[model samples]
Target: MTEHPSLNKKQKQLEPFIRDTFNQEMSSNEGIKIADDENSLKAGDRGPTLIEDFFAREKLAHFDRERIPERVVHARGYGAHGEFELYKSLSEVTMADFLQDPAKKTPLFVRFSQVIGSRGCNETVRDVRGFSIKFYTDEGNFDLVAINIPVFFIQDAIKFPDLIHSVKSEPDNEYPQGQTAHDTFWDFMGSNPETTHMALWIMSDRAIPKSFRTMEGFGVHTFRFVNKEGISHFVKFHVKPLLGVHTLIWDEAQKLGEDADFHRRDLWTNIEMGNYPEYEFAVQIIREDQEFIFDFDILDPTKLWPEEIVPLQKIGKITLNRNVDNAFSETEQSALHPGNIVRGIDFSNDPLLQGRLFSYSDTQKARVGVNYQQIPINRPVCPVFNNQRDGASRYVIDRGKVSYHNNILADNTPSEVPVKDGGFVTYPSTVQGMKERKTAPLFKDHYSQARMFWNSMSAVEREHIIGAFGFELGSCLSSAVRQQMVNRLARVSRELAEPVAKKVGVTVPEVEESTVTRSTPAVSLMNTIFVADTLKIGVFLADGFPGHEVESILKQWKDAKLHPVIVSNNLGEVSGTGGVKLKVEQSFLTGSPLKYDGVYLVGGTGADDYFHNQARKFIGVVYTHFKPIGARKECISLLEDMDINGKPGVVIEEDAQFGRKFTEVMAKQRFWERPSYLYYV
Candidate 1:
C-alpha cells in the first residue's frame, strides 16, 4: 500500500499493524495451513463433519463472535482519517501540545453519526448528528465528542436514559425504526419542559443536514482550558464547515430515506474523488470570572452562548484527507470518550458533561470489551507507560513482577511525572456547595432560547419548522400527546403553535405569549456561507445533443470544482452533434434528482417521449425541492411544460455568461424566495 502524503504520527503508528492478505495463503488462527478445508474432515465423502476439523471450528468460532455490541446512540456512523493543523499558537489559553505548535499537524479521526438510530438505520433521518473527533496528540489522545446542535434535550445527564427510551421505537411494537414522529417522543417532550429548546431545533432544518460536511459541530459543554500558568477560561469548541451549514428540505430528506447510506456514500465518494471535507476549528472562550455575568448558566448543557454575545475565534483547521481502509476495523472498532482529555484541558461542573465522562468509557468497555483502548484504532500514538494490567483481549505483555504503584520492585519504574514535567493536572477550582440533585436556577428558562431559535429562523425555515412539527405530531396516534405538545409550543410562539395545532387537529390555547423577541442571526441557516466547490450536478442528456456547448460548460464547471455527472437513459457512451461522445456515469433508473445538488438539462434531438417524460420528472422534483436547475435553450420547452420556467434558481443557457450565472445560482443552493406552494408539490 502506498503511504499517505500527509501522514502523521498516528498514521505511522498504524503502519505496522496494517496487514495485506494479497498473494498469501489462507491459514488457521495459529498460522497452520490445512488442506481439504472445504471437506471439513468428514468421516466419508458425504458424511457429517467430525470434531477433528480444527480449521473449520476456528473459522466458525471467529465468525460466530464477529459482531460486537453497537452503541446505544450514534450506532450508525461513518468516520475518516484527518489531520488538524493549528493556525496559531494557543499556549496562552491552552497548553495542549496539539494547540501549542503551529508547525505540527496532529493526526485525528472524525466520526459523524445520527443520535437516535440502530446500525442499520437510515442516515438521512431528522435527528442530532454526532461529530466526535479523537486527536492523537503527543501527550495522549484528546477526544472532542460533539453534536451538530449546540444545545441538548436535557440539562442534566441523569435524564439521558429516559430521553433515549422515549425517542426509541415504542416498547410494545418497535415500529418507526428511525424516527421521533411518535406518541412516546412527543409525550416526553411535553412532559419535560426543559427539552423545549432542543425540540425547536429538532423541528428546524438543522435536524436534516444536506451532508456531514455541511453541518456545524459544537462541543455542547463548557470546559475549562487552563494555560501554562494555571489561568483557566471556560471554553466551548466549534467546528465550522468550509462548505457551510446546509440542510435538506423535508421533501428531499424523505426521498433520501430510501437510500440508507446516503450521507455515508457522500462522504466516502467525496474523499475518494479528492474532494476532501474540511472544517474550521473555533472556540468561544469566556473568562472564569465572567461566567456568572451571563443571564444563562455557562454550565447548562441545554443552552448555548449566542455567537453574537461570544464571538468564535478560529484557531485551526481540520482536513479529512483520507478515507478509512476498513470500515469495521477503523471506523467501528474506534472508541471516543469525553474523559479522554490532554493536560491543559479539564472538565467543568456541567452535570451532563460530568456524567458523560463516566458513561462513555463504561459503555465503550461494555460494547468493545474491557481492553478496548488496546485496539489499534483506539490506541494512542505516544508511548503508554503505567502499572495497568491485562484484561480481555490484552495486546500488551507485562514481563515484570510489579504491576502496582508504590512498589520497590523494578526500582519503582514508570513513575508519575509532576505537572511541570508535562503531567496532567486538574485546575484547582474552588468549590463550596452541598451535594444536591438540583440544577442551577437559570436552567429553568428553557423556552427563552427556544423562542429565540424560533425568532431567528428565516420565513422559509419557520415554515419548514411548522411543517415538521405538524408531521411529527400528526404521526402520533394519541390526541392527548398532540394537544399537549401544541400547548408546549404555544409558550414559544403563537405563530408557530397556531398552525401546528390546526394541522394536528388540536385546539389552540390562548396563553401568554413570550416576550423574548431577540434573534441571533448566527443561529439561522439562511446566513450561512455558500460555495460551489464539490457540489454535485447531474447533467441529463440523451443523444445528438449540443455536445460542443455542453462540453465547454462542463469544463468550466470542473474548473470551479463542480462535479458534473452525466445521466441518460442507459449507462454507456452517448453520442452528440459535432462528433462529440461522452460517457454516461449514471442512468435515469440509477440516478434521482433528489440525490444531486442541482440538475442540468440538455435535450437530445433523437430523444423519445419516454426520455422527455423522464427529464420532466427530474425537473419537477428539482423544482419542488427548491434546488438549482439549469437548461439549454433547446430544453426550455421541457421546463415550460413542467410549469417551472422563469422560476427562482432556474438558469437557462441564453448567453455567453450562462455557465457563470448557473454556477453562481448553484452556489446559493436553494432559492427560498420561490413560491411556498411549489416546495411541497
Candidate 2:
C-alpha cells in the first residue's frame, strides 16, 4: 500500500505552517527580513548598547517569555501525530461518527506524560502516566483524557489537589523531585484508605512501563455512550497495545531514571525510524439498566470493571507514525478536555468526571489562555462557531459586525442545528438527588477490589509489588507512617503486608481481610503478548571477532526485526578475524546494560584487560536482571566464569544457528526462573 504524505489528515493541514527557515533569510515576527543579528545598535563599538535596536529587542523580549506555565500535573510530556482507523462499526452502542464508519479514519494527536512530575522530571520515575489523546472527527474534536492505570488515588475530583500535594515533595524542603516514596505520601494514604488500591498499582511494574507503545491506557471514569435510538450505556475506554503491555523491572527502571527521558527518547526514535506504534481501541460497555448489578459503584473513580465480566468490544486501531516538528508548538500548546465530546458521548454522574469537566476548562484558561482551543494542534477539523469574542493567543477572526445571538444584522448566522443533522444533544438523564458534598455509601469499600488486584497478580508480579512497598515504606522516616501503610496493606492481603511490614520494621496490625479471593487474570501483566519485533538488542564485540558469526547474527536480527546496537570499549571500527570490520555504536561507558532488551556476546581475542573485565561486568548486570543473553565462541568463557552459563534465558552456542535460538529467547522478555535472585544492583 502506498503511504500517505503525512500520518493523518490533520497533519497534512499543518504542513503549510511548518517554517522553511533553512533556505530563507531570517525574519522578525513580522515579514521583514533581518540584515544582521550579531549585535544590538550602539553609539560606537565599545559604547553602551542602544535601546533603538528593534530587531534585537524583539528577539530578546520573545526569549524572555518563551515558556508558558507548565501543567500542575502531567507537566513532562511527549506527543505524536497519528490516525485512528475504525476496525468495526460501533453504531449499536454509539452514534459517534468516528465509531460508526469502519472505512473512515480520524486524525489524532496523543501526548503521554508522567503525572505528578514537573516538566523536567524523568519519564521512568514510579508514578501514574497520563495518556491523553485528541481525535479530530468531522463532527467535532473528542479528547479521551486517560491514564495508564485504570484507577486513581481518590474517588472525588475535589480531593485531586490534596492527592497531588501530598504525593509531591514536602513543602519546606522540596527534595525528592520525581517520586512519591516519602512520609507525606504514606501519611496521606494511611489517613485516606480510598487510595489503597491505586497505591498498589503504582507500586507494581505497571508504574514503570517498558515503553509508551507497550503500556495500556484507560479512561479512569465511567462515561455514557448513547446510540442513535437514544439508548445510553455506561462505558469505559481501554487501549491495548498491539506490541503488548510490558514494563521495565525495578532495577532497570532505577538506572533509567538517572539517564532520564528514556521513555520519551524511545517514543521519538521509534517514530522517526518508521517503527510506528499501534494500539487497539476498545470499550467495556454496561447497559444503564444493569448499572446496579455490580458489587462496586459504577460511578466510583477508583474501581475498574473486570474484563471477564464486561467483555471489551474492539472498535478501532490508532497508529502513531509521525514525530512532532516542534515540541512546544505541537505538544505543549495542545489542550485536552473530557468535556470536549461529540453527540454520541456524554458525561456520566461520576463525581470525579463531573469536577474534571470544570477543572480542565479553568486550567486551560489560566495556562494557555481562553483561546487555547484555537491553537493549531488543539483546533478541530470542523468549523468552530461561537458567539464569544477574543482573548490572549486568539487566532480566529470573525468578520461579521454582530458577534452575539438574536442579531438581525448577521441574521443569526451559524445557527444551531437539530439532532437529526448531527447537532449536539445531551442524553436527557433525569436527576433527583439532594445537592450535597458526599458520595454513595458503596464507595467506602476500597479493600475488596484492592484484594482482588492482589489475588490476580502472577507470582513474579506479586514479588515485585512486595519489593516496591518495602522500598517505598522503608524510605519513610516516620515509623508511624510505615506502620499505617502496613496496616492498610493487611486489609488488602496478609501475604502482601507481612513481608512489607518486616522490611519496613513495622508491626502489621490485623485488619478485616477481604473475603474476595477470585482473581481477574486479564489484569495481570504475566498474560500479555510477547514478541521480538522492535526489541533493542545490545551486541558486544571486540577486535578479532569472527566475521561470519557477527554477520550471521546481524542477519537473524534483521529477520526478527530487532534493533542491534554494537557496544564495545570505544567508538570506531573494529576488525574481525575474517577481515570483516564492524562499527561500534556505543562504548561500555556510554551504553549501559539497562538500555537494551537483550545482549549478544560475540567472542574476540584482541581486547585489553579492561575490555575483558567490562564484558564480564555487563554480563553480570544482564544476568541479575534476568534479561536474555546470547554468547558465541570466546564470549562463552566470560559467561562460564560467572557460573551462569546455560541458564534459563542464556543461550550459548558454538555451532551454527546460534542467532536463531537467541532471537527466540529475546521474545520472552525476561527469564524469571533463574536460580536465586536479588533485585537492584
Candidate 3:
C-alpha cells in the first residue's frame, strides 16, 4: 500500500478495515458475483420478489436493518481525523502516555454536535454543542467527551433526563423541534433553581456560535489525574479554538433558516479546502488539598473554576485535518465515553461524572450493539487480547478453547498484567460516607455563580442576553412560568430580572440579590483572540469593474489567509475592465449574506438595477449584523443610497491601505457598538 503524508497510526490501522469497490463488479455480501441486481429476481416486470430468491432476501434484510437507533441527544454530528501534539511533559501530574512525550503526535478523532436537536434538526439553532474527542493513545482509547458550555443544567447526572425532556419539544403538542422558546422549558427552569447558572449561559451568545471552529469546549465534570507516585490532583479539561471564540447574533442566526446545515457545511468545506481547524488543549489543575477552597463545590458540574483564579496551563494542540470518508461508518457508529480513560486518569467523586461513567457504556451497548467496540472507528490502535466472546456483529475470533480466565486448559493465557507491567490500577482513595439522596450544602448556593456570569458580561453581551430572554419568554404561553422565572432571576440580579420581566409582562418581586460582585473576564467573548485567517468574505462584482484594484485586493486578502469567493448576479465568467473576466462562484439567489463572514461591495459601472438592488439588500443585512463591510469608492453612492455609509465597520476603498484596514476590521468579527435601531430596521 502507498503511504500518505497525513496517515497516522490509527489511520493506518483503519486501512485493513476500509473496503473499496471502486473498480470491482457487483457482488453479494457472501462474495458471490451478481449479474443482475436492479430487477431483484422478480417474477415478471414490476412483480413482487419471491422468498425463495436468497439474493433478494439478503438485500432486503440488510436494507431493512441498516439503521440503528439514534442517540437520545447529540443526534446530529460531524467528525474528522486529527492528531494531538503535546506541548510539554506533565509527568508530575499524570502518568498517561499521551501526556508524557512532547514530540509524539497522538492520532485522534473528534465529533462536533448539537446537544438538543434530532438528526434532521437545523444546525444553527441556539443550543449546546458537543465536542467529543477520542484519542487513540498507546495505553488505550481515551475519550474526552466535552461540551461547548463549561457548566451543565443540573449538578447531578440523575436529573439529566429531566433536563433533556423539558428542553425538547412539548410532550402534548410536539411543537418547537429545535428550540427552547416554549412553555415546558421555562416551566422546568422555574421549578428547578439548580438550572439557573446554565440557563443564563445558554441565553448568552455562546449558544449560537458562528462556527464549530470558533467555539470553546469543556469537560464539565472535574476529573482526577494520578502521577506515577499515586498522588492525585483535580483536573478540568478545556479546548480553546486558535481562531478565537465568535458567535452569531440572534437576528443573523434566525436569517439562516434556509440553510439548515449551516454549521456542518462550514466545517466540512473548510477542512476540505485545507483550512484545518486548530485548538489548544489546556487543563486547570487543583491540588487535592485545595479542593474545598472555593465557595462552590468543586465536584459540582454546574460550577466553573474561574480562569482568573485557576489559570489554564496549555499542554497540547489538536488539529483536525481529514474529513471522514463515510459519515455513517465513522461518525455515526463511533462511540465516546468519559469513562474510557487511561491508567493515569481516574474519576472524581463528581456526582454527574460518576453517573455518566455507567450511562454512556450502557447506551452504547443498546444503540451500537454489544460488540460495538470491534467497530473500526471505535477500535483502539493497540493490540486487543481477551478471553471473552461476543454476541452480535462480532469481528474477533478467539482461537483457543478457553474463553474464561485462569483456565487450566490453555494455562491461563491472556493473563492480566500487574500495575508495574502496564496494567490499569485505579487510584486507591479512601471512601466512607452514608448513602443519601441529599446534596452538599455548597451545591444549594446556585445563584452565586449565575450572578458572577451576569456580572462578567460586557454591555453588548448583556444586551444580547436580555434580547434572548425576551424572545424565549415572550414565546411562552404560560404567565405563571414566566413570572416564576423572573422571580428566580431577581435572586441572581435585579438588573437582569427587571428588563426581562418588563419585556415578558411580568413584575419583578422584591428579593435580595446575590452579594457576589466578582466577575471572571475570561468567560466573556469580548476578551477572546481575534485573527482574520480563514474568515470567508463575499466579493460582490459585476461587469465593467476595475480589474486591477479588485485583483490586487483579492491577492492581498488571500495573502492574509482570508477566503474570498466571487458573488455576482449570475454564475459564470463576469467581465471586468480590460477584458479581465473572473469566474463567479455564487449568484445572489444562491448565496446569502448569513453565509459569509463579511461583504465587499464593488458595484460595476455596467451593472443593471437588479444587481444593484441585490447588492444593497446584501450589504443592508451585513450592516445590520454588525459585520465588517468594504466598498469601492465608486460604490460610496450605493452605500449612501442605503443610508449606511460611515458606519462603524464600513471601510471604503479611498486609499491604498483599504485592504489592510478592512482585514483588520474583519478580524474583530463583529462591531457590537453599532446603533441598536439598525438591527431592527
Give candidate 3's error at residue 458 in angstroms. 0.3
Candidate 2: lDDT of 587?
Answer: 96
| Cα lDDT for residue 267, candidate 3 | 89
lDDT of each: 0.91, 0.88, 0.92
lDDT of 2 by residue, 521-550 (tens): 888998999999999888888888888778
Q: What overall lDDT, based on C-alpha atoms, would model 3 receive against the true structure?
A: 0.92
Candidate 1 lDDT trough over 10 residues, lowest sum: 672-681
**Model 2 — TM-score against the truth?**
0.98
Candidate 2: give the clashing pairs.
Answer: none
TM-score of every candidate: 0.98, 0.98, 0.98
lDDT of 3 by residue, 280-320 (tens): 99999999999888888899988999998899999999999
What is residue 339's positional error in candidate 1, in angstroms?
Answer: 0.9
Screening candidate 1 with a backbone cut-off below 3 angstroms (N, C-alpha, C), the clashing residue pairs are none
Off by over 4 Å in 3: 44-48
**Model 3 vs. true fold: TM:** 0.98
Cα deviation of 152 in candidate 2 (Å)?
1.1
Compute the lDDT of residue 85 as modeled in candidate 2: 95
Question: What is the RMSD, in Å, between candidate 3 and the native fold over all Cα?
Answer: 1.3
